[model samples]
Target: MEDWYYKVDEKFLICSICGYHYDKYAEYDEENNTPFRVEISGGYGSVHLETKKGDWIRIYLDGNLSAGELKAYKNVFENCNKEKSYLMTYEGNGFFTIHFGNPPEHFLISFKEYLENLPEDRQNDVF
Candidate 1:
């Protein structure tokens, strides 16, 4: 995941559930200290929603997202969206979808790849 998308998704999740909206983490032009909403960072994994006015209520996930805490995550995001915060997730498919605004974003996360990256049985602890 791109670094800034986490922040965007954080804000997106908050907006989707709480119905509260604000652009708290506007991009900082450190050299100029100017506030610029980057909208979509790295062309993926980020959305620079310029306006702080919105009503995001209800978020959910389907598809290959079947397994373990993925359902819990879906429920949490759904409740949060109903309460008006936001998020998405899935299981072994190694991918999930995140919906925001006019369009949605799909992400990939390979558990097998992650396991391979881990040294020895360290992957066991990940479960």
Candidate 2:
């Protein structure tokens, strides 16, 4: 597997390969400095993965993810075992699923409730 990284610019969060953008600031709260909601659609709301052939594949997350949920995703991505885990998108679906391990374990991940409520010790456990 090749090294993969992502960057968050003023407008978008883009991955190294393909440079596909994801997570755009949408509605803001009264403070205006913090985003209350984020838009996740089209190529702008997708995760990019490099294939063995050096091509790129995208997992589109259509809909909205709260700031907390977004942070949870970032934590998981940053802490997970990159070589063993992958993010997957189901057809006609708008959420991301995490897959990992030798036996090929998988789980559907959506909303802030799931990720944010994990025990503090297990918060970074992505497997």
Which model scores highest in lDDT?
2
lDDT against the true structure, each candidate: 0.37, 0.44
Quality of model 2 by C-alpha lDDT: 0.44
Worst 10 residues of 2 by lDDT: 98-107
lDDT of 2 at 124: 61
lDDT of 1 by residue, 20-77 (tens): 2234355665765666442321111222122234434333322333366555554544
Query: lDDT tens digits, residues 1-127, model 2?
Result: 0222224322445432222345544457565567544443343244544444455444556544466765665565565445543444333355434332221222343424555767778766532
In terms of lDDT, the poorest run of 10 residues in model 1 is 41-50
With a 3 Å backbone cut-off (N, CA, C), the pairs that clash in candidate 1 are 13-85, 13-86, 17-80, 17-84, 17-85, 18-84, 18-85, 19-84, 39-47, 39-48
Model 1 sits at a Cα RMSD from the real structure of 16.5
